[model samples]
Target: MQFKNIISGAAVLLASAPAVMALGSATVVNNCGYPIYFASVGQSQHANMQPLQGSYSEGYSQQGVGISIKLAPNNTVGGPVSQFEFTWANGKIAYDLSNIDGYPFSAGGMQVVPSTQGDSSNPTCVPVDCPAGQSVCTAAYNAPDDVRTMVCDENTSLTLTMCPGGSAKRSVEVREHIRYRVHARHFTVEQ
Candidate 1:
């Protein structure tokens, strides 16, 4: 009877653990000429707006539930922003590039590359490549119900690059209505 109780308790503990525990780390790299700000939103711990200059990388880990890393050209919130969204569940990481709000980095472009080839069981596992100046990229989510999500192995880390090749000329207008907020620390930035 004691053994049975122990087994049941163990099962409960495992079930309660956050699914994001299976997810690998995520790294965001800024390759654009100007500084870009990023913030994380969703079930995981929220991150405040933080700046990343050219040629710098930021690494972070997500907790349970879904998370979206939003990027903007300036250190503000609530404007046209590009997002890298993901959820880790059942040993797979489902991810997508979201432009539903707007594509603030259309002039520079962005890419999300998984460290490993997508698991053979999933066909939608592939890198999201939004070319420079492409305001409407089909590879990313344009609407709420867009079928653009991709899946990869649970252990596969991701590298999100802004302006993949080199610095892109700024073409998007920085709207004046954006709400400014104080920056907070939640991730490690590497040069």
Candidate 2:
């Protein structure tokens, strides 16, 4: 009789173990703006981006176009919204990024105002100062008035954004976007 009772107790403990584990994971939480897309500084493997097909304003000027691409649902993708490799011939760019990742254009012309609005906003450094050994701190291209800006050129600048992880339930470590500013002329003289 005692042997049968022990077996029954073991079965009851096993049955309740699952319930306890399920209760531990019962709490649900989510964040909408966690994985934000900001400017990066290099080429991305995500080379299948298509054009947004519309004019987007950076601050006051409108020069560049926009596109909406399906960010491939993968965990291996990473970049700061750098130079949009627009394959105009192929009618494709690399990725579609409005809120996700992109460079907003000014209205006047190709002369783009460097600002940290969309992909330019997320800088890796704090406003105060860069840590020891670091030459220049990474900052979003915000100061259009200042000659030195992060978003100097597309070749040097990069685009970055967040994407879903390998597993939906698994938590992913967030990384900051790093874009290198390319050489650009702020003002020009027309003859």
Candidate 3:
């Protein structure tokens, strides 16, 4: 009876050995919320990727201003990886404008209008305050208003007001709007 028990235990150990030694697959996936757009990737070090045995190289993508890498099976290798770096984008507007009277006040928001019919060569003028009696002025700025959620490509009209934060009264052609640029960035990690 003792000999039989010893033989059965050895057989069970032998049967599970192969299962324990079986290696896991390597896969990469984007677990991040942001996506990278227009990206370049390389090993963090000059030595290139020091992947552990049984591990494999996956791939990457540029979503908005974020970069995502995907892996399969997610196992095997010497150990976990370090960190990664990248660059990307944020949805922003850009343009030029000319104003005439009271500072342009559109409690609504600024509109980004594209044109080819109008004089494209006209030099973009600087924003200036209206002289006495002049209720209008002209300037340009990428609409920072939360138009993405409120309005979709709304026309950038104007209200001749005493100040930017003032109340709107009469409409005017000369708009003292703001023109500027925006920069966006993002990062990712792998283990």
Candidate 4:
């Protein structure tokens, strides 16, 4: 009888208490004038993430977790409106911003910036920091501005915005991660 009562009490308590799930936090900032929908490509394994933080942004989870968020301009995901918050595992990621279409006429571009060291996924990433208002695809023969790589090993903030005019992009990190980033000409992703 005592055992039964104890079990029932425990059940009640458990049922009353909310379920706490563990997830990593990652933030994507929008510095662009227009809105952008950002999505995180799932990794077979979540590398090594820790300490879940903030709510899921744009339906992104370590995997099989929460509803994806439809990111909008100025609105933030997995973080405050100003900056993005990332779970540990999701926090550390490698991404690049490049002009896939060598459209010589296109002037818009994106720049990938990271706090620590980062590397490019493209071998032909002839790193060149082209400022905003300038062109990355030069004459279609020459390579556009260098591709930008970012690695947020620690729980840090990553800003995704249009390439600023004549911004200097840097790269200095081992190819430890395999993430992809491609900036299409005046493009938006809806997934």
Candidate 5:
């Protein structure tokens, strides 16, 4: 009886392993009066992304970012899909869902409307996790408000949905009615 129990437990764990590793979501909501386009990027190193060149190579954006696996290779979102997926490991991931390049600065627009769930402290399993308005730099190279970080002890799914034009924070850089708040949720990925 003891041997049978151990065998059954191990089998269950093995069967559910793939489903766990292949987990994560970034649901971008377009609250800006106009449409929005952006990418959910996961980088092994967080310090190098700057100037906003959306590429799936160069060690960072390659982790996978798209509406679906079918549209992810290009890693751009503007069509029918509104969801994204990526893999996380090594306890933490450096990531961001940004629309800086696509944002109509000339039109005085804002993107990434998040809820009050946006957090600064290095938290575990919290959805829509972001760093404090980065003081690391003030130039264009500085981390955008959309920049985020995730820390969890086990394989987890951290998600954030931006509700722009809602009750989100307003940046001083651009003086427009456009605001964003990110709501987050952390939960275990099950088989």
Candidate 6:
């Protein structure tokens, strides 16, 4: 009888334990003058399709799996779109801005800024600021082999802004070497 009681008590304690929390969080801000629609694409689930008008914001947390926040000026999915991709795992968050599909916000731009500085040894922890009208931003992955991935501490919060201010106009030479490369695959979740 005592053995059975001990087993029952252990099961109760295990069941009452707190669930494992996600290691990363992201906030999306719409700084554009018009409304934009965003969808969260993850390995298992795709959700949160909502319209964000100027100055509005939405936030979410996710486990250490690949996720992409797809944004577009219109509500439809076939039109021009951009993406912010991230995966939080192994004590770090690997992230990148992808213009591989298309860039809808040419007049405005997008940026991903980390809440805190990442590992000092990793130089790719800097912010990814893709200026307006830059179709081939060097800070983003322009091709499948583009070396634009950045990393930050897993606990570092990230803020993604659409149409951020001070997006200076700069001319960047499109890398002729990878111009013909195919677009890299992006995260997608079935509805």
Best-fitting candidate, scored by lDDT: 1
* Predicted structure with the largest TM-score when compared to the true one: 1
Global lDDT of each model? 0.80, 0.26, 0.26, 0.35, 0.33, 0.73
TM-score for all predictions? 0.72, 0.17, 0.15, 0.31, 0.31, 0.67
lDDT of 4 by residue, 45-149 (tens): 222222223223332245333222223222233321111222333434433343332222123344334433443432322222334445543312233354334
Clashes of each: 0, 39, 27, 25, 12, 0
67-180 per-residue lDDT for model 5 (tens digits): 221111122433222222334444344333333322222122222221223345444334432233332211111234634433443223333323322433322244456445
Q: In candidate 3, what are the lDDT values of residues 1-191, reduced to their tens digit?
A: 99999999999999888643211111222222222111123333222232223222322223233221211112321222112122222321112222211122222112222222133332221122222223322232123332121111112111111223333333324466654544466443322
- Relative to the unseen true structure, what is the C-alpha lDDT of residue 47 in candidate 4, on a scale of 0 to 100? 21
| C-alpha RMSD by candidate, in order | 13.6, 21.7, 27.9, 18.3, 18.0, 15.0
Instruction: Write the residue-wise lDDT of candidate 2 on 41-67 in tens digits.
Output: 223334443332222112111124332
lDDT of 6 by residue, 1-191 (tens): 99999999999999999976455577788877677888878875555666865443333355566888888777866766688888877778888988787777766778899887756766677899988776667787767798888887776678888878844332222354423334477544432
Predicted candidate 3, C-alpha RMSD: 27.9
Q: List the candidates ranked by TM-score, beginning with the highest.
A: 1, 6, 5, 4, 2, 3
TM-score of candidate 3 versus the correct structure, residues matched by position: 0.15
The residue-by-residue lDDT of candidate 1 on 1-191, one tens digit each, is: 99999999999999999875444766788988888999877774566888875433333344346878888887776778889888877777888999998898888899999888746776666789999887798899999998998887777778889999889977577455644454475544333
For candidate 2, the lDDT comes to 0.26
